[model samples]
Structures are given as structure tokens and as C-alpha cells.
Target: MAMRFSENADRMDVRYVAGLARIALSDAEAARLQGQLDDILAFVGELKKLDVSGVEVTDVATEAQNAWRADVPIAGLEREATLANAPLARHGQFVVPKVIE
Candidate 1:
């Protein structure tokens, strides 16, 4: 069953979440997104009402195995060649503009 929520409650919750996430939203945008989020939550709530007592649960959904290659050491670019592309380099390292005081 879909859960019902008040418009005021939805607006408040969505606005709070948007604020915490540092997202700027106008009143119209917040109202629109609030309705969308509410619909999603309602659908999830409906799914929770399903009877899955006989269903088997597994960690993975697919039978595919890990296709990762074996770790093997390979030749890498020389330090001189690597540093040649750096816009700024100091003491054998790339020098970036100071971001923090």
C-alpha cells in the first residue's frame, strides 16, 4: 500500500534534505522534487507488502565470476618523461596552487 504524506510535511522534509546536501532549490523546484520523492517512497512501501517467504536470497544477483586479470608487474614510464608533462614541478613532484591556508 502506498503511504500518504501531507504536502507541508513533504515540503519540509525535502527542503531539509536539500539544505543538508548544499543544493539550492526554489519553492517550485522543491515542491516538484518533494512530490517525486514521495511517490518513490510510496512505491518502496508497496514493495515491502509483498510475500517473499519462499524466496531464496543470495548475495549476488548474477552467476558471473570476477573477471579481474592477475596482478603482474609491468614496465612504467620513466620519472623524467612523467615530470616533463607537468605544468609546474618542484623537488621531483607536481606543484599545485595552494588551496588551503
Candidate 2:
């Protein structure tokens, strides 16, 4: 169900929202939070009254294109040179401890 807020209507129920969130709020805390939430909803109500017919919808703020480079194959390090610093090497490959039975 959609929840709406307006000056003429009853303010949002903080206790209901708290219950949905699985939170336990004391009466005093619920009252305080209710006032804060009401103010936020009122601000949103004000924003809904604004006219933005001339504004353009945009996905990004900047005009820059994708910064990715083309993928290409290149020569890699020699196996012998790479295994030189290995603690264990076998059959031109690094040997690691067995992790599973």
C-alpha cells in the first residue's frame, strides 16, 4: 500500500513504520521521530509543486565518452623468470598446498 502525507490528512504513523522495520521505539522517541518525518514529507510535498517542463532529463552530468581501451594480446613474462622467486615450482608451474581432500 502507498503511504501519502499532506497537511489536511493525519500525519504518518511512526509506530507503524517502526513495527515494519522490526524496531522497538519508546513512546517519546516515536513522537519525536514522527515530527521529523512529517517535516521531511512536507518538504517533498513542496518540491512536487515545482514546474520543470523546460529542464532536460540526463543520464550523466558530464559529456565524456567511455574511457575503455581496446583489448589486445601481448607478450607475457617468461615462465622460468616468473618461477624464479617461487617457494615451490613443478612442471613449469607454481605448486600450492592442497586445500581440499
Candidate 3:
């Protein structure tokens, strides 16, 4: 858990996070956000008063980690055998549309 960022997460942090999330908060929004963040920090502080001494941590998911076989190098399919299933190929690679364009 991060301590209160009020001392460090200034307008710069809010702005940087907003930029990464593609948000465009106005002056009022940023000011409101600062207050909201402060309240959230205070609430988190309140939770620290709990006594969870014997609590056992748990995995929240039903899925289990897949255990693999021994580390011996297994033979893989040949390049032509694998590429045979691709819808289209160029230079022995899958030819998807250029995403950045």
C-alpha cells in the first residue's frame, strides 16, 4: 500500500496519469480530484487499524497454475508445418494489418 501521495503526487502525477489514461480533466476537475485523492488516502489509513494477525492469504481465482513437464528440450513443429495453418503469410510471418498507421 502506498502512503499518502499528497506530498509527492502533486498536479504533475495527476496530469501524467490522466495523460496515460487519455483523460482531459479541466482545472475544476483536477482540483476536485486532489480532494478525492486526499479522502481516499485518509480512508486507507483508517483500514490500517484492523488486526489481521492470523488471517491466511488466499487466491481469489478458481484457476490453478499449470505445472509443466520436465525441463528437457522437446521437439517443436517445423516452420512450414506451423505456418501451414496461418490465414496469410509474408516472409514466413503472419500478415496482419499495420496497426500503428
Candidate 3, residues 28-95: lDDT per residue as tens digits?
A: 99788867866877677676688878887687665667767887898898889888989888897887
Evaluation by lDDT, superior candidate among 1 and 3: 1
Tens digit of per-residue lDDT, candidate 1, span 9-57: 4323677777767688898998899899878777666766899898897
Q: Write the per-residue lDDT of candidate 2 for residues 70-100, one digit (tens) a residue.
A: 7997999999899999999999989988858
Each candidate: how many clashes?
Answer: 0, 0, 0
Q: On a 0 to 1 TM-score scale, where does candidate 1 land against the true structure?
A: 0.48
Predicted structure 3, TM vs. truth: 0.41
Query: What overall lDDT goes with each candidate model?
Result: 0.77, 0.81, 0.69
TM-score for each of the candidates: 0.48, 0.42, 0.41
Best by TM-score: 1
In angstroms, how far off is 72's CA in candidate 3?
A: 31
Give the 10-residue window scoring lowest on summed lDDT in candidate 3. Answer: 1-10
In model 3, the runs with Cα more than 4 Å from the true position are 1-12, 61-101
